[model samples]
Structure formats: structure tokens, C-alpha cells
Target: MIYEICVDSVAGVRAAKEAGAHRAELCANLLEGGTTPSLGLIRAARRVTGIGIHVIIRPRGGDFLFDDDEYAIMQTDIAAARQEGADGVVIGLLTAEGDVDAERTRALIALARPLSVTFHRAFDMARDPFAALETLISLGVDRILTSGQEASVLEGLPLISELIKRAGERIIIMPGGGITPRNAGRIVQAAHPKETHFAALTAEPGGMRFRRDHVFMGGELRPPEFDRLVTSGQIIRTVMKNTTG
Candidate 1:
């Protein structure tokens, strides 16, 4: 089975490669559920990892609907990702009515030619998964990263399996979200998907020698300032072993 690691940094890309992941879905601010990475970050990741790099094209977190300006930003990001040598890009766009933004999605797909494209977890936020699946297939999207419209893949196993069967060879249905080494094997066995996506992250103490407490840089709902989350190669290796063994 092909394994794709959701990573937020160059270090994460390196870790994913070392651990035998088939690809890295590179993003920034994964805590915000992933956003478009900077061009510099994309270039750095390409330099550091030989594995496939699929940069996420989300401008921000929260909803998949985009304003005209935000849509334009996404267009620019897709071009930047391609310029930076990314092997692929992940994107999602939805209409106010909660359907796939087919027109805009088609435009971006055309622009991202020669590079594989994955419709990110925004598929989970779609109002109708089956309709969206058909729309994406019509647009020629390569794959979709979804959790079956649920909070986790395990909870959405039944739908995931159905989606895979319905998709046939028209598109790839990749299960992602809340997957761990413990449950990876079970999800694989149940869904029988061709690929899986997840992040193997761990909190590591930041390189701060001084003490600075109570000053929230990210404003209240924030992670610890003295600690950072990073992908762990060992964790990825363990998950791979458990998944494919």
C-alpha cells in the first residue's frame, strides 16, 4: 500500500523519506489543518527529500469556500508549487451551496498540468460526497484525500469502502485523519484502499534557553511556545511496519 505522510516542514519531509513513505503532503501550519506553504518552504522541502512532494494549496483554514481574492491566491500558489519543483499539489474549493467549485477547480487543474493533483480533505466538508466524487472525476483530479465525511477514518470505514468501490479505477480514494499505527492495519484491512494518509507528529521542546511564559504569540488558543510539533521518522517506520506487515 502507498503511504503518504502529512508534513509541515522540511524536517518533516526528510523524516517521511527516511521512514519509507511514498510521498509527503507538504503544508504549513498543520495545526490550522494545513495551509499553503511558502515558496521557500516548498523549495527547501524539494531539496531535502527525494520522495514525492505534494504541496497543499490552501490559503487558510476553516472553510473550503473561497472569495474571489482567495481563489486568485490559490491560483498563484498552485503555480508557485509547480515552479518550486513539487511533484503534485493538493487543493479543495467548494461553493456556498457546499458543492464542488467545478469551474475554478478545473482552471487550477489545467494550470497544474504535468503535476499530480489531490483534492484535499475538503472532500470531507462537502455536502454530498458521492456528487463531489463524480465532479472531481469529471475534472480529471488524480485522487482525493478524505475521511469519509467523518472525524476519523475508522469511524468512516463503511463509507470509505463504498467510495472506493464506486470510484473503481476512475479515481483514488485515500483514507486519512486520526490514523495511527494501532488502527492503520484495521483501516487498511476494512477499507482495502490503495493508499493511506496521516501525520506521525510528536511534540519536541524548542531550542529556547530563556524563560518566557504567559506571552501568547498566537493569541489565546495556542500551542506551547517552548515546544514544537514535528514528524517523527521512527513513528512513521513503526506505522508502516504495522500497516504492511
Candidate 2:
């Protein structure tokens, strides 16, 4: 099985490589479901890890329906990912009507040529899963990361399995979201997918010896100021063992 880990840092990429992951989907602001990472981060990850680095090309978080300005930004980001020597790029776009934006998506795919392209979890938000699958196949997307239009992979296993069967040799259907070591084996056994994506993250205390507890950097829904999430090599290793053994 191909293990693709979603990571947000060069350290995370290194951890994934040491733990035997085949690839890392590099991103930033993962709390908001991942955004395009900085060029420096992409370049550093490429230099530090031998595993494939597929950068997420999202300009911001929220929905996959990007405005024209955001679409232009995505195009620029794809070019930057290529210039930074990234192995692949993950992207997604949708029409207002909830279908794949074939026109814009096709342009992005054309720009990402030679580099592998993965249609990200926006597939979950699509109006019709089967129709979206066919469109992606026709657009020549290399793979699709989805949770079967549900909140998590476990809840979406039935649809994921069917998508894999339908895709056959045309495109790859990669299951992702809420995939932990505890359920990794079960997912593989049931879905029988060729590839899977997940983040084996652990929270670590940030490096701040002194802090003002009363202050908040973000708005109402803010994360803890002194804690940060990082990928755990041990967790990845355990998941790998559970998945294949």
C-alpha cells in the first residue's frame, strides 16, 4: 500500500520519510483544512526528504469555490511549487452549482504538467460523487483524496470502496480524513484501496518560557497559544505496521 502523510512542516516531512511514507502532502494552516505552503517551506522540504513532496495549492481555507482572484493566485502557486522542485501538487475547484469546475480545473492541470496532480478533498463537497469521479477521470487527474462525502473515512468506507472499484485503472481514489492507526487496518481491509492519506499528528508544547495568559492572537475559535501539532514518526510507524501486518 502507498502511504501518503499530510504534513505542514519540513520536520514533518523528515519524520514521514524516516517512518517509511511514500509521499507527503505539504501544506500550511492545517487547522483550516490546509492551505498552500510558503515557497521556502516547499524548497526546504524537497532538500531534506527523499519522499515525494506534493504541495497543496489552496490560497486560503473555507470552500473550494474560488473567485477569479483566488484562481489567479492558485495558478501562481502552482508555478512556484514547480520552481521549488516539488514532486506534485494537490488542488481542487468547484462551480457554484456544486460540480467540478472543469474549465478552470483543466487549466490548472495543464499548468501542472509533468508534476503529479491530486484532486483534494473538495471531492467530498461535490454534488454528485459518481459524476465528479467521471469528470476527474476525463480531466486526467492522477488521484483523488476524499472521505466519501462524509465527515470521516470510517463513515464513508462504503462509498470509498465503490469509488475505487469504479475508478479501476483510469484514476486513483485515495481515502483520507480521521484515519488513525486504530482504524487504519480496518479501512484497508474493507476499502481495499491502493493508497491512503492521513496525518498522524501529536500535540507538543511550543517554545515559550513566558507568556501572558490573558491575550489571544486569533478570533473566538482560537487554538491554544502554547501548543502546536506535529507529525509523530512513531505513530506513523505504528500505523504502517497495523496497515500491512
Candidate 3:
């Protein structure tokens, strides 16, 4: 199976390539799930990694419900990804009622032509996975990254397997979220998906020697201010070997 390593930095993309991954999904702030990485980051990753670089076009974290301006920003990011030499774009838009935003989705897919388009884990948040699958298929979505609408793919294996069976060749169902080396084989065996998404990330101390911990940029539980997340090459290799072995 082909693996798409989720990465937040150009460094992670390089690590993925070194660790035997087929592609890397470039995003920022993986803490908030994943937001659009900076254009500079996109170019840097493209330059450094020969493997495919699929950029996540999310404007921010939180919900998939986007307003008009946010939608416009996503469009701009898609265009930028294309111009900046990304291999594909990952995006998702849901209506207020937790359904696919067909019109908006179609528009983005059209804009991302030639380059691949994956409807991201926003599929997991849909009201009905079956209905969402139909909408994506009708829109010509190339692939879908989902966790089976549960906290993790393991919890949603039944639905994931069913979706893979029902989708047939019409759409690609890629399992993502909380897939570790220990469970990668089981997930692949159960879901039987062509592609899989994972992040072999670990926290390392930040470069700053002198630190101030009084203020927190994110939530209280976030890693100490001096700690940052990075892709673990060893973990990536282990996950890949287990899943594909």
C-alpha cells in the first residue's frame, strides 16, 4: 500500500522521503488538526522532496463549516499550491448541517484540476458517510481520507471496510488518524484500502535555549512552550514496514 505521511514542516517532508514514504501531506499546526502551510513552506518542501507533496488547503482549524471569505481563501490557497508546484490539494467543506458542500467542493476540485484532489478527514465529520461518499463520487473526488467517523480508524473499522467495499473503484477510501505501527497492519488488513495516511511524529525540545513559560500560545495541555513536534524517521519506517510487510 502507498503511504502518505502527514507533515507540518519541510523538515518532515524530507524525513518522509528518507524514511520510505510515497508521499507527504504538507500542513501546518498539526496541533489544530492541520491548516494550510505557508507558501514559502510549500516551495521549500517542493524543492527538497522528490516525492509527491499534497497540500492541505484548510484556512484554519476548528470546523469544516466555512464562510464566504474563508471559501475564497481556500480557493486562493489551491491556486497557490498549483503554482507553487504541489502535486495535489486536500480539502473539505461541509454545510451547517454536517453534509458535503457540493457546490463549493466542485468548484475547488475544478480549480485543482490535473493535480490530485483528496477530500480530507472532513468525511469523518459528515452526518452520513454513505451520503458523503455519493456526493464525493459525483463531484469526481480522487480520494478520501477518513477515520471511519470515529475517534480513530480502529474504532471505525467496520464502516471503513464497508465504505471500501461499497466505493469499489468509484473513489479511493484512505484510512487516517491514530494509525500506529502496532495497529497499522490490522487497519490495512481490515480496511483493505489502496492508500493510508499517518504521522509518525514525536516531540523534541525547541531550539530556544532561554525560555519563558508564563504565556501559552495554544491550550494549557499543549507541550511546554519550548517543545515542538517533528516527524520521527524511525517511527515512519516502522509503520511503513508493518503496514506493507
Candidate-wise lDDT, in order: 0.93, 0.95, 0.93
Taking the tens digit of each residue's C-alpha lDDT, what string does model 1 give over 219-241?
Answer: 66888999999999988998889
Clashing pairs in 3: none
**Model 3 over residues 51-115: C-alpha lDDT tens digits?**
89999999999999999999999999999999999999999999999999999999999999989
Order of the predicted models by TM-score, top scorer first: 2, 1, 3
lDDT of 2: 0.95
TM-score of candidate 1 to 2 decimals = 0.98
TM-score of each: 0.98, 0.99, 0.97
Off by over 4 Å in 3: 219-221
**TM-score comparison, 1 vs 3, better candidate:** 1
**Residues 71-178, candidate 2, lDDT per residue (tens digit)?**
999999999999889999999999988999999999999999899999999999999999999999999999999999999999999999999999999999999999
Question: Which ranges of candidate 1 are over 4 A from the true structure?
Answer: none
On the 0 to 100 scale, the lDDT of residue 212 in model 2 is 89
